[model samples]
Target: MASFHHCIKSGKKGTAANHAAYIARQGKYGQREDLISTGHGNMPAWASDNPALFWKAGDKHERANGAVYREHEIALPAELTHEQRKELVDDLIPAMVGDKPYQYAVHAPRSALEGKTNAHLHVMFSDRMHDGIERSPEQMFSRYNAKHPERGGCRKDSGGKNRLALRDEVIQTRKTCAELQNAALEKAGQTARVDHRTLKEQGIDRTPERHLGPVRIQAMSEDEKASVVEARRDHLHRRAM
Candidate 1:
């Protein structure tokens, strides 16, 4: 139901590090900005939130990051939302974590169907009670690492047969949401915010795979792709040399 991936991105152009640049555009190192929009070479927002929570370097961090991404593919029903998301998450996480501890946050996508399902949870927590003496950042990070070993191991089947299943699930979720909302919309006699069928029509969520079987590989002409050796041989023979 969940997976994680962790990468140590820094303030770099064309990468997520750029996010810090936008937030810290005018300010000195410690000052805050007015309207922060993520930009190139920007400070890591997660770090800004809590310096102790900077991304660790390792495989486990990557998997927890992946678990967060997987939750998006699972697609929360629209009835579930920012407020409700946390409440349910609180309940569901216990099953995931037992009495051990961890910090977790949901990374809601801007749009669930954008293939941009990357908006995800950011959780850095420890199941081990810190003695405050022997524990290292590596030990803290390993708390999640030890708990979730499957991170970044496999991306959700955004390809092949599983791709089709994902499509169907997303579409159905939107439809169910639409039907319920519009029913409530009628109860209030108000206009609808969306058209679920329009989504299906537009191939946004849960549409069937185009399902074109066995892509026929067009053969390149032997004449067109002739190797240098073959071309030279042909040329020499043709010249009667």
Candidate 2:
């Protein structure tokens, strides 16, 4: 499961809007590489101010252990003019899920990624809202937690216990984008239309609150490779789906 969170920047917008900005970045970029100039917020202005502080402020909220001691952000979409997209994302995420429901950060592609101009945002939030009632996000996370997520939706009616709702929410957003894009194309009288389902299948167009489990090792011998790969995929799918 991919994570989604409310990104924030104090003073620019209200708290909730500030918090959810990053997801919009990734949403625009979809799948690509090297989106962030620094690990922090994609501020070219801040880059000159202080390189060290930028990463610290934008340090990887997740991935504190394993191989990465320091946080690194992945690609965000370039389709957004940075300023325009950040504002759009910040407002939308909080407006949808409410702020502080989860941890958030913007992810841009690392330089190693190829042909990627997109800088996307990634977030990890509870499926619960701060609205004092179980929300759609809670319900979606609940389903995943029921089978996985380690603890089963925090084991409380305080939040939802279903997973489909959250997945659908992300999927729907992609759909909305597709529809808008299609309309724009039609307005221009162009034959091109976006195949929106691709995002659903690829999982980028959707938001995932839970952590995707482990991946299997590669480079095994042919005799062992097939079984190992199959097992790995099955395990991940069981948890992720």
Candidate 3:
């Protein structure tokens, strides 16, 4: 099954540019030139504005710096060839970014010894718009309120009272991503698909296995292995009850 991971990175200490540069492989001595790709949607001309500037503008607040950018890592179906994977990602980008300024890069999988060779896409986007107008911290990051002192607010909730919370937005985004991925797989005649729901939500009753890192597992003593097995057995027994 395809794997889905999403996270938000804060630009609190003015490191947004660094993060953008890293993802875009802009600096010298960057690795794997063929592995890097970038795109932007609903954004100003690439010559004028970039991901760093987009996120920096959103984090103008001296205090209470909100999430400057969000990111997603989605595993591409291995059944598809390189060209098909690129097409799938191209289709996904526009759907994911909507009107917000965004940037994405596709990373190639490592050698076979590195484990799963699942190619994935990394996307980063600003939560605010690019209206070319200066805004206060509260105005830029907070919910929309006409009566408030600041101007040009962000998105609002369904009731139109407070700003739409990030948590809700993330959940919706995950569901949308799963649907889009499944569609892409179907188009490619691939049977593998992804799930956005948690194990409980999917009615999975078994205890999920803990991820022991490769190095830790390799170095584990026999006693340690037995301890882990016993712990997992106990967990499964409790869940069964």
**What is the TM-score of candidate 1?**
0.27
lDDT against the true structure, each candidate: 0.33, 0.36, 0.62
After superposition, the stretches of candidate 3 with alpha carbons farther than 4 Å from their true spots are 6-13, 32-34, 45-64, 111-116, 130-166, 209-241
lDDT of 3 by residue, 138-164 (tens): 455555545652554654222233455
TM-scores of the models, in the order given? 0.27, 0.33, 0.67
lDDT of 3: 0.62
Q: What does candidate 2 score on TM?
A: 0.33
Residue ranges of candidate 1 with Cα displaced over 4 Å:
1-54, 57-74, 99-101, 112-133, 138-241
Best by TM-score, which number? 3
Q: What's the residue-level lDDT of 18 in candidate 1?
A: 22
Better candidate number, 2 or 3, judged by lDDT:
3
Evaluate residue 223 in candidate 2 and report its C-alpha lDDT on the 0 to 100 scale: 54
**Residue 147 error, candidate 2, Å:** 26
| Residue ranges of candidate 2 with Cα displaced over 4 Å | 1-76, 110-116, 131-170, 176-195, 199-241
